[model samples]
Target chain A: MTHPKRVQLLVGSPRGKRSTSTAVGSYVLNLLKQKGLEPLASLWIGHILKSPEKIDEFLKAVEAADMIILAAPLYDDCQPYIVIKAMELLAAHQREQSTTQKRHDGKLFSVIVNCAFPEEHHPETVLRIYRRFAKDMGFLWGGSLAIRAGEALQGRQGKTLDDIGSMAKKVKEALVRMADSLSKGSPSADETLSVIPESFSHGPLSFLGSFFIWLNNRGWAKQAKKRGEDVNARPYME
Target chain B: MKALILNGSLEHQTHLAAIQEILEDELSKAGWECESLILHRLKVGTCIGCFKCWDTTPGICFQDDQGREINKKAIHSNLLVFLTPLTWGGYSSELKKAIERMLGLLHPDFIKIKDSYRHRKRYDHYPSVLGIAVGREKKDSEEEEIFKTLIKRHSLNWHTPKQKAEVFLDKDDDEKIRESIKKIVVEMGVRK
Candidate 1:
């Protein structure tokens, strides 16, 4: 496959521009921009989905692009509702195009999925769904990268990968690598992304999971305490 | 006994509708007070990732919507049923909105289960889950596997006593759907 001249980033967070999903996706987008690509566009699905005109415009942008990079969070073990809804619309559009004897063959589809959990394994199912979408829709599979402990990045909102320093070192490197491949119009090998050398997983630091859970529990406890509510309250049973 | 059937179909398909009817009829025959909800028609809003449900009021979403009522019924029911068309090996966006809102049902704390960390359940007795996903065709086995795994992962995290995930195709007939519902009710602790 040849390199794509036009690449579009689809941000699937409900928070739109302020979301970490956008930050991560935009990081890669900036890398691609520096690689001498055309001016990039990042379409936040959350803002445009409810309006018919905006959604059509989003679809047109997608159709016009040679590649689509979907950056979304893992919700309920898979993708959020907005992402799925967007996919449903895109799938329908692709089907319509197919019926009309039109094809956007060789369009590359890639995924950057992040999860709150501190385990790389959690986002596996969502990544599989994305690969299936590409395969079924006839796009070349551009591979996927799943970020673990994405909640940790919430504190570093609005900061670029380089600005975050060590905490985001691996992620920044991964995105750069991914951008490098995309810039050459080459689909990332499925095997290359899976071997990220424990990127964002806190490799060999097993205590991070329990630490995150403890810290999460404490934060919620503090919030509940301020409102005079019990974190463990069984409201439904009573 | 009570059963809450959450129908998450975006479009009304005869096959999925037949499956819903079969499940409701079986639950009713078994002396269950069954309520089936068509999620697409509900005025439920998407979860904005605010932890208000857990941080402010434990076990209840602050958002004034049908999701709170659905979660209440789900907590009280003996069986919580999910009915949906599996999109890209997952539930439709409509059904997922309701599911995300139910996060209030789990506390922010996590407990290790089978070496994986999951949210702790907020209530004493959690209901059994039965997920039935309709696929576009029978040959879509890979997507079906992913969908079933997604349900099982949910069951593990929800700490359900019993759980089952079934995938049906558009060509699947009424009798086959009925048989599957019978198996779930009889074996998965709903018909007790």
Candidate 2:
């Protein structure tokens, strides 16, 4: 007669349902439901009040969940202000949990940052920010996904229907993989780091690679200008 | 020069007080007129992202609460200092709420300049920001973590001089930290 444990979802996009986070959040929730797991989706957009009552409500949901997924759009290269508030609330809630001798069992955590820039260009700065939060809040981060602008949204006719379908399928697959890891309660500490390649990566080699790309981009700009072509002739490569 | 000091730390904690005391003295030494807002003592709410400011209103949010009131002062100041405690590798909940609420000033719908224009059609002034995050002795490293977490690429790209300062109060060198705060204050004091 026991029901499956719950997974609470915090989607931080002021854009609401139209946000890429919503798309990914829905995919994750549906994936969990298919596995007979209850997914509670909480949309945290505008007006993140800090009243005790509001904090208590959010804490109750977070504590009840087996895992927490923080989905947000990258703003100013970081999460929206509400996401920061949510993390603050969670940290404080943990202190309360400690007094009651109840350790939070919420295991897996991940971030999905919908950035306007192509995922390849500069997702690192945002990823670094998210990973640091994940560590500070004591969450076992699975990974992250960065959905570039104009790739999947409405009225972006460049990507074919098949491309969109593939993207959705890949996203669904990633969510399922993450869920399976979460259910085991033995999540790895590898910190998959969600580098889309298409996104940025960690370590020294990536830094060197980035520097080279910067050099190349600068060279391209110089050559264009010398040719009397507009350096702004084309938007900077994603 | 006028400086607006905002202590966004919840409960007006000692660490923020240390920063304020040191900053005020340094700023006074440098001859800057300082106006500080100890944020936690005031009432401020999170941004609702209503977009009313951009679409319906030109430069004001519908909510004329403390956040907007503070924004008015911020506009008048030449420098803005945000002193906050690092809570879970980021700013305090109260601080984040205050920053987000300031979004009303950046509403594109409120003032639109066409791409062809080289200058702003209507200018909204934003003061230089100095973000200082202090962590407890047991969590000094966490302060840097939060600093990295909060400073985004786009923020760095902004032409304004927005700098970040951090101190692990538990293991901090008071003199060096004071000097750093002083440098910022002195610059603010001398700026136009």
Candidate 3:
């Protein structure tokens, strides 16, 4: 079979194109661009929810693409509702005609997930869920990349992976590695998994814990203060 | 005791509806008041990822929809029962909307639990969780394991004192389904 080349990125953050998911996903797609693959412009799940035309347009694009990359933030323990909605709709759109249970027609499915927790493993469940999605839809699993976006990016939204400077260096390398493998062929499950184990758990490296905590706490406090709201208000405790 | 069952059946498949019925009837007989929400019927808006609930106006969502109300109800309840069709081994989109908006119910600060660090609950007490993922076939696939693991993860992340997950196959008879749910209730320590 010819090498799967067409790449369509679906950013699942409600913040749309200005999200860290877009940043990370776009960086990879741009890298794939340097190769021979022609990646289509990203389609944001949150943007086309209400527009039937846009939704149809993207689903049509999915049919034409060789690979689908879902870049989403881990909300709670799973993908955001918008992304889940996209999954539901995509299932209906893609498999409407398939009579078989699993349609492995040489398509590929990969995911890029971001989480707020200091530990990168927090997105594990979401990643597994997406992998399950790949199986259910009969897409070749292209592995996943999970990052501590809120802190590593220092709560930076609307910033590209390149624009985030050194903080994004390691993640960028992993993305480049995955892109290289994808541009070659759909990775055989193990090839795309380049997890960054940046955790603040109590251990020999626990000294770095406070730094992340301080950055996150300061960012939330400053944002809350700017809006003049109590960051720690326990409304339910009353 | 009060139980909140978030019904996530997308099509109300006959077996699933029966399971929900048996769940409500059995839980009521077990000496608990049940508030079951048919999520698709409610006007729950999507969480806009606005950290306003966390940063700007803590413990509050600005949507003014059923999503906010569900969060309030969940935090106040003694038990949370996640009922879904195991979409990709996770809650359906209908059920996930409420769960996503529930971010405010968890404090953004990480609290170490066992091996990993997870966000702590904002309230003094958090309700234990029970997840029921339904499937049409009885095959034991990766989806079932993924669903179970996600629930167990939630038990830790959401700080649930007790939790259980069961996969209900469409081929399952009413008695088998009831037994599975009863096992969850017993495991959850909520069976009065």
Every candidate's DockQ is: 0.79, 0.15, 0.70
Q: Sort candidate 2 into its docking category.
A: incorrect
What tens-digit string does per-residue lDDT give for candidate 2 at B1-192?
Answer: 777888877773666776777777777667789877787778776565454444444455667688887867766676777777865555666676676665544423111122110112123445676767777766456447557545433334322355554544635777977877656554544432
Q: Using lDDT, give the best candidate's number.
A: 1
Worst 10 residues of 1 chain B by lDDT: B9-18
Off by over 4 Å in 2: A1-5, A14-20, A41-54, A116-126, A150-238, B107-125, B145-149, B152-154, B162-164, B170-176, B184-192
Encode model 1's per-residue lDDT on A9-94: one tens digit a residue: 99988767767687789888888889977634689888878899999998899888888889898888899989998988888888
Cα-based TM-score, every candidate? 0.93, 0.71, 0.92
True contacts kept of 2: 0.20
- If you superpose only chain B onto the true chain B, what TM-score does each candidate give? 0.94, 0.78, 0.93
Query: What TM-score does model 1 achieve against the real structure?
Result: 0.93
How do all the candidates rank in terms of DockQ, highest first?
Answer: 1, 3, 2
Per-model root-mean-square deviation over C-alphas: 2.6, 9.5, 2.5
Winner on lDDT between 2 and 3 is 3
Question: 1 or 3, which is superior by lDDT?
Answer: 1
For candidate 1, list the clashing residue pairs, or say none: A3-A185
lDDT of 3 by residue, A1-238 (tens): 5787799999898877777788888888999889889898788899878799999887888877888888888886788889988899888776676576335556878787777665656677888888777877778887777776354663335777667677777788888888987888767333222223444455676656766666667777678778888777887666
Tens digits of per-residue lDDT, candidate 1, B1-192, equal 888999998865445678888898999999999999998889898887767888888888888888888988999988899888878888888889899999989988977766666898788778889999998776588988998898888788788888899898877888887887788788887776
